[model samples]
Each structure stands twice: as structure tokens, then as C-alpha cells.
Target chain A: MIRGLVRTAFFVAFCAVIGPAYAQGPLQLASDVFVEREIAKPDGTKAKLLEEPKTVVPGDQLVFVVRYKNVGTATASNFVVTNPMPRAVRFDGTADGAELVSVDGGKNWGALATLRIAQSNGGDRAATSADVTHLKWNFNQPLSAGAEGKLIFRGVVR
Target chain B: MDNIFAFRRNNRPARNHRLALGTSLSLLLLTVSAPAFAAGTVAGTDIQNIASATFDSPVGPVTIDSNTVVIKVDELLDVTVVTTDPGDVITNPGQTGNVQAFRITNTGNGDEAFSLVANTANGGDDFDPSLQQIIIDSNNNGVYDAGVDVVYVAGSNEPVVAPDQSKTIFVITSTPAGVANGNRANVSLLASAVTGTGTPGTSFAGQGQGGGDAVVGSTGADAQASSFLAVQSASVTLTKSATIADPFGGQRPVPGAIVTYRLVATVSGAGTLNNLAINDPIPAGSTYQAGSLTLQVAASPATTLTDAADADAGNFNGTRIAVSAGNVPAGETRTVTFRVVIQ
Candidate 1:
């Protein structure tokens, strides 16, 4: 009876340890946000972004990029992101170059066309709303585990 | 042995039940703790680090405003009096006259409002009262007598001045004919203006009156006033002039050759020019030869040229000749000459 009890206790402890490991699997999510000077390198190594505080003169265009990866066993689905714009800075656009997202703080997004037709006519250019300083990226498709993605936005210092 | 075997068989089922219960409890604990730990760790790292990183920048200094004043003489007062007796009736009769004027102005960046009160000091002769009464001490005494005091002719006092504004006051007097033309007098013009005022509660009442009243109601928080006085001596005189040929033999200087030339100046004004100094600048392409200057005035026998040869000589290096006239008398002329060579 004592031997049976010992075996039973051992089995219970083993299950406790293995169950969490099995449930968690290889799921992981990591994100890095930074700024870089050059976009390319000849040696196959890209230039790293500077992490120090930088002074940007007026009328300078600043580009920020965020890289995210799903280093997990399961897919990351319905990914959503939001960034707030800093004071004394303005967003440029969003059409691969620039774009207008929405009126309700980027809750709903469409191409610049829909925004222009609704806010201004096709004749007028789209501008960032006063309250909207941040840039956001949302994905409708799932990111397979181990897949990576990046989002970029441009702003001008006033 | 038979009893032990039977006990083992009875406990097996109970052991299995206990194992199942332990596993379920372990799983439940991990499930509850995982979400809490994840949320706390992520938020703690991001929010706290960012909050600390963003801070305040420092600031620097600021600036203010200021002003200044300068006075210059434009034209000297020239007074001439001629007396004629219809029948040459009185012998040794005397009369006095004078010409006086003051050039006061604001040559600074801002407007200045000020006042002037002048008093004549007794040296020897009396300031003539017949002249415009900017100020005068007639009895050779140091006190001002209201009844006998001369008043500023018509428009002597200026109330206000914009930047670079100026005003001139004139006074003139005539002397009786047959009076010896050797009389002399000293005159003084004292000018003062308030610049600023102290704080509202500060008391500036104890500062004596006179020109200080000019800045009484000024907006400046600190009231300040400047007082300056200039003294001039008046006299009667005779004058003469003469020109001597080039002291150094005249030679037409070649394009690059240097030739020395000389010239003299004589003064016959009422008052001998005190601390008389003259500046003669050589033409742009000229140079002064060494030791080519001399003073020939009998009254100013101890005169010297305060310039060195080979120097540019005209306002060049701010050099000139200075002379002292030991009370030159009326109707006499004194002369000084210096030489420079043209390069």
C-alpha cells in the first residue's frame, strides 16, 4: 500500500509539471520600436536604430518603425495596434506613403479616398485631426507562429 | 504474508483517486496565476520605464534696454560792439557788452525732459546783466538777486526733446565807447535733467531742487539726473594775420619724393586760447620731416610740438602742438608754425 501511494504521488507531480508546458507550447509575442537612419546596407547587415534622445529641428520628417513577431506554436490573430503622436509633431499620410485612417481616433480605417470624400472633396487634401497624433496598424489576417511583421509611419516636427 | 497482500489490494483504488485530485488542483492554480503575472509584468516594464524617461528641459536668460547723452558746440558766439560819441563829449567813458549762447540737446536713443539753473562764480569781473539772463552774477557777489537778475530773453528753456533734438539760447550785450578794451569776465552754464525715478513708495523729496525737477513725474522706476556745467571766459580784443613763404626752400615734390612745407596760425580773440592746441594733418600722401616745427609767440614762449617726425602728422596718431599764453594782451597776435613733407 505504501509503494502504491508513493507511485501515485509521483504521477500527480509529473502531470502538474507537464500539463502547463503542453498548454503553453512555443507561443510567444515580442515587439521592438525604434528609429533608424539608413534603410539598406551592402553587407547584408541593416543599420541599427539609435536608442538615445535626439533633437529634431523644425520641419524635420521623422520616421518610426515597429517590428513584431509571433515566435509561438499558435497563430496570432486579429492583431491590433495604436500609437499616440507627440506634441509639436504632425502625421504625414498613410497611402504606402501617407493615408488618413479615421475621424474617431483611428477606430475605423479606410484609404485616403473615403476620408477625402467624407471630410473634404476629392479636390482637398486630407490632414491629421487635432486630437489624433498617433499612428496605428491593425491586421485582419492571422500571423502564423514564427512569422514577423513591421509597421512604419512618418511625422513632421512642427 | 497473506495479511499484507490483502491490505495492498484494498489501497490501490484510493491512491489513484488522490493522484487525480492533486493534478486538478495544480492545473487550476497555474491557470489563475498566469494571466495576472503576464499583465503585471508587461505593464510594469513599459509604463514605469517610459514615465521616468520623459522629463523637463531647462531654460536660460533674458535681456533689457538702456540709453546715454552727449553735448557738442556748433557755432561760437561772436559779439562785436562799436561805440561812437556824437561830439567826443566824455573822456575815458566806459560801456560793456557781450554775446552768449548755449547749445543743449538730446543726442541719445530716447526722449529726455530736463531743466537748467545756472549761477556765475566771482573770479574778477561781473557777468553783464544786460545780456539775456540765462544766468548772471552782476555785483561780483556769489548770490542771485531776483530784482536785479536778468531773465532768459525770449525762448531759452526747452520743455521736451525727442531723440537727436537740439535748442540754442542766445544772449548779447553792448559796451560803451571809449572804455579800455581789456575787460574780462567768466560765465558758467549748468545743465541738469532727471533720468529715472525710484519705486512708488520711495521718497526723493530731500534731493534739492533746480534741474532735478525735470524728472519728477517720469515713468522710470529709479529717478536719476545728470548735472554738467561748462565755463567760458569773455573779453574784448584786436586781431592781426600774416603769411610767411615756405620756411623750407620750395621744391616741387616728385611723385614719390617728400617735400617739407610750413604754415603759421595767429589768434587775436579777446580771451587767449587757454591750453591752445592745433592739429594739422598732412595730405594723404605726405610725411613730416624730423624737427621742423617752431613757436614764435612772445606770450607763449614755452610751447612745444607734441608730434614725432616720420609719423602721418594729420590727426595721425592723435598728435598736435600745445602752447601756453601768459595773459596775451588785446590788439596782439601770436603765431605758431609746423612743417610736414609730402611723400
Candidate 2:
């Protein structure tokens, strides 16, 4: 009986420590748009492009950076992060060279041409920019503790 | 008083000038008297050279050579082209040597050089404007001729326009001497950033490169374009014939015979001719036949006589026959018929 009581206490202690930790996650996401500027280095050869940005206007190419970090003590599981391409901007999928899927409001996915959209004339046509609703990246690996990286894609403000 | 800009802006010119003078005088005394004060201290109070410069640099100074350093901050690049016309219009085989004006604005923060291009077959036009020349309105008189305006410099160092400034351009296009009737053309004036043109087809100078450049508007073309119309003028022809009926009730041309005169006006082009007025003086030794004037337009019925006015269709203006046809559309004809009695 005493041994049984001790096992119960140990189990309870384990649950107390691990349950809250499992419930709380540390994978955070931060995204912003930045314009590329050519910055002159102190060496003064020519200049190198650095990410210093201000206001964005029409026809200006912008880089959208998504930074993720695992600030937890344990590793994180496989997950997917999605960012809706702002309707004001157009995404060409080459900005960060990341594997991406295009989504429609109604569950459709694939490339720009293979996807089909409904036409007002009661017919289906190849999907275009209006079909692109969201961009998603599926992380295959386990996120280690203190791991941080960036995912970027390019777009132009419409 | 709370805002720095407001303080400066609200300050009077005299006060600002006095403050600026005081600051300049203090700085001048400090700079000019420095060498004299140094000499007074070195030689126990004496004279000195007024013109001398001090040095401070990474390399230790040998007090030998005088050199100057210069610094420049890179400028922003922006430019735009727009037409002041509510609509660009010209006539073909019509008005020769006409001018269509446009304004090119430099919206950049720095001075810019623009490359001018005149295109007859530019994009987004149903037809191409047969261009003659594009000139800078040097005299600001809004006219273009050989010596009156400087012709456009093709793809080279052109005008250097300052920031937030504009230049007047006169696009010279014409309906050729023998252009076909109803011919229409389009002329597009495009300006590009020649701020740093080295080669022929380079896009533009990068920002802060000490060159000139501007971001093109949303049209995806580096230059702004507005097309002007050149339409062929409607050809107008007038034919007159006279038939005389004597007291014997037959057609004759002699005196004492009633002469019936028919004047036909025909127009040919793509546009309507408005405010068309035709006047014919009564032939000598002839008296107009009262109530005999009749006007007939192509699409409408005929009308009887009236009097001289801006609105009357047919009238007699004291020894003359007048027809005031408001607008005779293209491919239509107007006929005025009246009788005159031979004296």
C-alpha cells in the first residue's frame, strides 16, 4: 500500500511539471515588409544592398520576412505557418525561395495555371491572382530549443 | 512658440536677418582673430598673417600643403509627365505646324536630366501619330518652328530640371500635305531618366549614385506618355448653278428673267463642321425673289426663307443670300436655293 501511494505521488509530480510545459508553446512568428537599399560600406568600394526600408509605394518590390524562434526548453513538433498575402500586394513565390502553396478561399491549392476558378459565365477557367488567398510553409523538422530562423518571400505593392 | 518650425516661420525677416548677421559676425571674429591671438601668445603680443588655415586629419600634419575636402549627400529620384490639355486634339491634312503642349515635372529631391523620346507607334493607341518634331518651348510662347524652339535631343544629355519643377514641351505634328481624308494619328511624348546615361539601353541610375533618375509611374514604362490626336480636316466644296425663267415661263439667263440659283455645299471627313455659314452677294443687275429662298439639309426636310441671324437657317442680308446651317455632319450636303429677278 505504501509503495502504491509513493507511485501515485511520483506520477502526480511528473504530471504537474510536464502538463503545463506541454500546454504552453514557444514557437512565435513575426513578419514585416522591408525595402532593399544599397548601403555604402566603410571600405567604400561601391555599395552593398542592406534591408533598410521606409514607406512603400506602387511598383516598389518589397521583401516580407517571417522570423520564427523556439524560446522553449523542449523541442517543437512539425507545424505549418501561413501568412495571407495582403490583398494590396502580389506574391510571386520567389521572394524567399521557400516552398509555398497557394490557397483559394474555398479549399483549392496548386500552381497558378493548374488551379481552376469559377467564371461568371458558369464555366471554369485557369486560376489567376484572385485565386491566391494565402501562402503556407510546412516545417518538416523538429524545432530545437533556442532555434531561430527566417522565411522570406518577395512581393510588389499593387 | 511651441513648435520649432512655427517659431522660425513666424519670426519676422528683419529679426531673422539680424540673428543671422550676429551669428556670422561672431563666427568670423572667432576664425579671423584665431591666428592673431595665437601669434600674440607665441611672440608676446604682435601681428600675424590674416589668411591661414588649420589642419586636423588622420594623417599627422606637416604644415605644408593646403587642401580642400568636399562632401555630398545623395538625392532622391522622381519624375513625372502629364498633359495640361483636357484632351489633345489636332487636325490632319488640316492645320499644319500646330503645337500640342505638355508639361514634364521633376518630382525628385535632386536635379535630374531627362531623355526625351517622341513615339508615333507607342503602346496603347489605336493608331500612331505621325510625328514631325518635339521641341522645348524655349520662349514659353507655346509655338514651335525651326528657330523658335530647340528640337529634342535624342537619347542624350537633355534638359536638367530641378526638383519640383516643370518644363513646357511643344509636340509638333501635322496632317501631311496630301494625307488622305479621315486619317487620324497619335503622338506620344515620353521622358526617361537620363540622369546617369552612359550606355544606350541602361534602365536608370541607382539611387545615391550621384546621377539622375526617377521611378516611373504605375504604367510599368519608365516614361510617362500622353497621346495627342491628329485628325484630317473635312474637305468642303461648294457648287453653284443658276436657272432663269422668263415671263414666258421658260428657263433663261437674260435680264427681266427670274433666275433660280442653287448653291450646294458638301463636306467630307470624320468630324462634323459646326457654325457653318454661307453668304452669296446678289448678282449685279439682279433683285432677290421675295420668299423664294429655300434651305435643305441632308437628313432633314427643306425650310423656307428667313432673315440674317446666328440661328436663322436661310435669310436675306440686304442684297445677299445667307444660309446659317448650324452643323453639317461629315458625308452630308447642304443646299440653298433662291430666285433673283434680273433688272
Candidate 3:
């Protein structure tokens, strides 16, 4: 009887310790990165994966919305994103549009200026870091454990 | 030994359960991570594939019509000659030392540059060797040579032939004294291009290189050079003389005897004659009897009659002689006679 009693107490203590750990659940870091086409208000509520626009004639104004959320335990800080400009599109500067960055597919992004000058010297206008046309919003304000933010880009479809 | 065996059996099941749980967790982590890596991956597609609209503006075709350029030669210009000697009269057989002048002119739409070559044969098909050769140098070099070239250089001062523009040229020929009565000769005027045929190159210097020269090669022959011929035949005819006798000799009042004069003129040539005018002026001393001045042949009208009552009477103006014969047909002759007497 005493052995049974002792075994029950040990099991209770094990449950007490392991239950909290198990109940804490997975450190789930999930986010729904959404891109919305800016149409008339009600229709534009539908968001999708970021995609290039079609039928971009010589003159057209376009807007893009990039929404990101952090539904995780830890804050997602110091995050950087890079995107490439389409060949058929020209970049209107950030005053009217978006801030953009480029990494050579994650190779040597720090010395981007020198790398860009070298790339321009190499006759590759598209390879320069300054050639990026993507919207980047550095969440200098951390994404506070389960927060959301958005980046907007207005472009002239040339 | 039993206690040890039982303990080992219990621990084996627990170890299997833990292994199963660990496997499930690993699978869940892999599934979630796999999507994260694939979230923003974009396929590289060409712009042409994603374009939704296209616009084009096509230009229409054009056509141009061809133009015609025609050059024609139209008139049988006259040649005139005068002699100061009384014995040198132009007549049929037995006539002596007469000089004849030919006046040729261009009555066509374009400039008629021609050369005169004499041949005795009636037709251009045959050449007579015994015929005296008269090689007239159009360039006036005073040398009788075969193939001596005469160039009709275009003059800036000369008028361009709009239509029916005329230019006259003359040739004078003398008949030798006591020659055969029926001697005759044919004079032919040959017309040819003075410059190279076909469309002339725009620039004399750069013909072979570019512009139109590359389109039409420099060595290609111009097709516009062509030749035409005109022939005129003149023959000396026998002169017939007859006296008009007064039937009644002795009369109280003898009016001046009236007489009639007749002259026949015939022309035969390679082409048709048009707008032909003949002028015969009476000798200064001869007087025309009243009511005797009249042309017998209406076709060959007398252009001038000094004795005509009206100033313009008997004048042949705008009269044409038509020859219905075939090419190089028999000669056409017409008579024009009027009366005159010595006062």
C-alpha cells in the first residue's frame, strides 16, 4: 500500500512538471503575408499573394499593399526583405513609391553600394542594389510578439 | 531473475511510445517549415506571357500610276534657192546650171535634230554606187568624211518645244551645166539621239555608285535612243515652149494680144506632205494681160500673183497636197498656169 501511494505521488509530480511544458504548446511562428490589388474599396478587400500586374501600358498608375503578421511567441525584429524590379517596369523614386533593397540572392548584401558600382561597371544595370523596386518597411518598432504591419507601393506602370 | 525480466518488458513499451511521439513531432515540424521556405518563391515567367492586351496601328498600301513620254516628228519643211544668172533656169531635160535651196524645219512636239545624206536610189532598201555622193557636214567642218559625227548640243538660250515649235535649216545644191535632162536625186534626213538613250543619269559623276545608279546598273544600256528618216526627191523635167499666134492679123484696132502661161510642179518623197505653200513671183519686166491670171491646178495653187486685182487674190494659204499612193509611190505632179506677155 505504501509503495502504491508513493508511486501515485511521483506520477502526480511528473504530471505537474510535464503538463505545463506540454500545455505551453508549439512555438508556432505563422504569418499571412497578403498582397492586395488596390481596386475600388469593397473589391480590394480581397488579398492574395504578391504578383506582378498585367497589361501595363505606357501610362497607368498602380498601387500594391503588402501586409505581414507575426503570430509567434518571440518578436520578429531586424527583418529585411528584398525584391527585384521587372525588366519592363521602371522605378519611380521612393518619394512617390516604395523603398527597395537587393541582395545578390543573399550573398554580400552589406557592401551593396560598392557591389552596385562594380555591377554597373560590369555592364549589368539590372544587378545593382539600387535597381530594386520592392517595398520594404523595416519594423524599427518590433512586431511585438503577435502584431501586424503593412508596406505600400505606388508605381507607374511603364 | 523474474523481477528483472518483468522490468525489462515494461520499459520496452514505454520506450516505443516515446519513440512514436518523437516521430510525430518531427513530422509536424518538417511540414510547417517546408511551407515557410516556399512562401515567397516566384517562378520566372516572361513579360510576354503575362501581358493582357496589345495594340497596333497598321499602315495602308499605296500605288502610283505610270507616265507616258512621247516624241514625234511632223513636217516636210521646204528648201528654197535662187540664182542671179539668166541662163541658169530650173527646168526639165536640157536645162542648165540651176541652183536649188531646201528649207527644212521641225514641226513636231520635240526638237528634231537631223542630218542630210544624199542617195540616188529611189528607195532606202538599195544603195547605188554610181551615184555622186554628197556628204554634207552638218558640223560645217568642210570635210566630206563618212561617219563624221554632228552633235546637237542643247542650248540654254534655245526655247523648249512646248508644242508645234519650229526651227528651220537650209541646204543649197547646184546642178552642173549640160548634165543629163532627166537627172534626179533623193535627199534623206536622218534623225537620231544626240545623247545616250534611256533616262539620263541624274548626276554625271555618281552614276555607278548609289541613288538610281544602284537600281539601274551603270553598264545597262539606255533604251530611249531611236532613229527616224525623211526623204525628198527632186527631178529636172523637160521644158516645153510654144508660141501663141494671133488668128486675125490685119485689124483697124489691134488690142494687145492676150496669152496664157502654164507651169506644172510635182513632188515625190518618202513621207506625206502637209501644209504645203508654193510661191512663184513673176519676173519684174513681164506684164500680165488682163483676165489671164489664173492657176490651172487648184491643188497646187499659186501663192503669189503680182497682177491680181485684189492684193491677196490667188494666194495659196493653208493648202495641203495628199498622195494616196503606197510607200515610195509614183511621183505626184500638178500644173499651175497663168497668162503673161511682154509689154
Candidate 4:
């Protein structure tokens, strides 16, 4: 119920007025961000724990998780997910190396090392992790009915 | 310099437009400019993220956007203090109102107040200077004025600074009496956030300006810097005495009496005296004796100089006797004696 309220609050006013259109859609998408905490145990060891971020600060690492599910009876094919980086966050990396990145607002997409940013002085520089503006993953296999999966990425607050 | 100019030129119009629109647009435009990672994202900033997914359905292609997620940035308390005075401040013994300049910067991403203190009793120095007052620069001029600058009071006038902004201040002190020349004293100034200070990552609930949590930064919300005061004094001391011998076999002032004058000169302190020459005028009622001028260095034999201005280091003109003793180092002394008969 709390998640439903937060989703309603996130939607635009026009979309909120015309609700239930996307609620009945075949594919449902949900996104959440978290901060990793290191918990120390009595055995003299530490474990990495993820929790809902409450007080985020600069230099703190964040985990972005996107869950997608197909609710319709029919199968979905050519699945592709795209996430734009926030202005105040620098892209770290994804859980897997299967994703492609765009440094120029999705104008071009390639492996991070193969990308270059064109400068106003008629020169170009190698694109760094900070230059990543968009992330995308393509799934070749078709999604069966009621199939669900999640994509994870990390970033640092600038 | 070129990059800064071009960056300002490219962003000024966008910045003005953002001012009319809102802060979210301004933040979006800020990403276009480079080299802004120093102060990081501002406190209370809402970092928003949204994801979209598309898949070909059995009928047609479809696209969907995930629910937006926002994480509000919290306040980070940090500070840095640095001395602005070039080298150590040169001072003298018993000097008062000596000032050591320092700059305090709020290196955090939120507005903060800082309380300042100066300590002079730090070790590894010859002596401790007495601390007087701490003054804040009231006019933003990087200088200290007695009445113009505001005196910093612990609670009443703690300095309030914005993110990445610095405040210049002065730590006033006085050197104690009997401090030897070339002696050094050090003074340190410490500035801490008025809200609180602790280890990094320590958080205080509801103490931040935006009603969020405040966390300590890498500096622990406190910083300190030291400035030095060095005493510099170079001086020379000279004393003269005269004795008379009468031609009538008595120590009396008489005609044809031989009057002998002795002058002792000494150099003291950390510096050397270059080309130190002493000249003594003859008495009004006396006449100088020929070849009577003598120059004697510490244990050296006395050497007489001629009356004429010749190749010797000493010379006697018609009215005075002059001795040229060059390069007198510290703790060294010289003596000159001459004879003049009473008229």
C-alpha cells in the first residue's frame, strides 16, 4: 500500500487523473535505490548490507535496482531496458558487463572504452565513467507469461 | 583561465534561464559544465532516477517507465583552516598587537557556523607569545584593523559561512619581555562547526538546516593551522672614555698635556654589521698628536695609523680621527685609542 502511494505520487498530474491505463498494461516496471552499510558481527568480521537510503551524502555509493514483470497471458519478446543517469551521480558499473552505455544523451552507444566525447575545440577525449549518461540492456530471449527479473547498477553521488 | 572564461560564457544564459524556471533545471544544466566535484551535491538535493523498459508484444511494440525514486542528500559537516601570513611574522621583544593571518573555509555542502580559538602554548618553540584577541574580517578585505574588524566571540558572533566559502581572520598576540633575538614562537588557530563534531559518518538527527540528518565529514568538522612569530633585532653598542696626563708630572688639565681617548665597539644579535666605521671629532681646545691613532681587535696588537689619509684602515683628518672596521660579526668587539694634547 505504501509502495502504491509512492507510485501515485510519482506519476504526472495528467497520468494520475487518467489512472488504471498503465495498471492493466502487460509489462510492469518498478525501480528503487539503496545504500550499502557494513555491519560488524561479534565474530570479528564484517558483512555488506543493503537498505533503503534515508540520508544520502556525497561520495556515498548507491545501488539502483529495476524489477520488471510480464503480467499478461501472452509472451513478450525483444525486451530492452534503459536507465538515464542522474545529473548529480557518477556511473560506477553494472552487476554484469552485458549492458551498453551512452555518453552523449543516447546519441551513440558502445562499450565504455570505445566511446569518445567530442570537445568544442574540434578535439575529442576518451569517455570516462563519469561521462556515462545512459545505460541499456538488451535481452535476446523472449519473456514468457508471468516472467520477472531485476537489473542492478551502482553509482557514486558527486 | 581560458577554460573558466569559456565555461562562464557558455553557462551564464542557461543559468539565468534556470533562475526563472527552477532549481531542478539549474541542476540539469550544471552537468554540462565540468570540474564541479569539489563541494559535491548540495544538502537536501533530491536525486531522482527513472528507468524504462520496452518489449514487442504479440500485437505491437510497447514501452513502460518505472516509478521514480528520490533520495534526499544530507548535510556533511566539514571545515579547513590555513595560515595566510607569508612565512613567519617578524616581531620584536616586548612587541604588542602582533597579528597572524589565517583563513577558515567551510568545505561541506551546507551552510554552517564555526567557533574559533587560538592557542599559543604549543610545544617545539623557544617561547610562547601571549594571545590577545581573535578578529573576523568585517569588510571582506584580507586585512586586520583595530576597530574596523569585529572581535570574534565564542557564542555571540560565531562565523557563518556558505559551502566552499572562506573567511579571513586574524589571531592577535604579543611577545613576552626578555625574549632573545632570533627566538621563535608559534600560535595555532582552531575552527570547529558550531553544530557539532565527531568521527566521520557520525550523524545527528534533525540538526541540519533542511530538517534532515547532519553527518560528520572527513575533517570531523574541525581544522587547525599554525603561524609563527620570530624575533628580529640587530644592534651595535659603543662606549668611550678619556684619561689625561699633564706635562708637569700630574694628572691635570694643562697646556701640553697628553689626553688619551679609548672607544670600545661591540656587535650583538643575529645579523652582521657591514663596513662599521667609527669617527671621533677632536676637542675644540685640543690638537691631535701625529701618528697617535691606534686600532686593536680582540687580542690583536695595537697598530698605529698616520695623520695623513693614506693606505691604512685608520685616518686622521684636520678635525677628527676615523677608523674603518668592516664586517663585524655578532658577539665580536673592537677598540680604538687616540692621543690628543691639551692646548
Against the reference, the lDDT scores of all candidates come to 0.35, 0.55, 0.30, 0.82
**lDDT tens string, model 3, B56-97?**
102111111111101111111111112122332233323222
Worst 10 residues of 2 chain B by lDDT: B62-71
Q: In model 1 chain B, which range of ten residues has the least summed lDDT?
A: B47-56
Chain A only TM-scores, each candidate in turn: 0.52, 0.66, 0.42, 0.82
Poorest lDDT segment (10 consecutive residues) of candidate 2 chain A? A20-29
> Which of 3 and 4 is ahead in TM-score?
4
Candidate number with the higher DockQ (2 or 4):
4
Please write out the lDDT profile of model 2 over residues B1-343, one tens digit for every residue.
1232243356432210111111122123232322111101111111110111111212221111011111111233456787665665756564556667778876544456777777667655445545777788777665555686788767643777765678878777755565565455567677766544223222342443343222332322235667567564666789999887898777766678998888989988767787788789998889987878889888577788665554657778778988887787779999888988898
Worst 10 residues of 3 chain B by lDDT: B48-57
- Judged by DockQ relative to the true structure, which candidate is superior, 1 or 4? 4
Candidate 4 docking quality: incorrect, acceptable, medium or high: acceptable
Best by the TM-score measure: 4
Looking at chain B only, the TM-scores across the models are 0.26, 0.48, 0.24, 0.65
* By lDDT: ranked, best first: 4, 2, 1, 3
lDDT score for residue B74 of model 2: 26
lDDT by residue (B229-275, candidate 4, tens digit) is: 99876567999999989988888989999999999898888556778
Position B276, candidate 3: lDDT? 38
Error of 4 at B176 (Å): 2.4
Candidate 2, residue B255: Cα displacement in angstroms equals 14
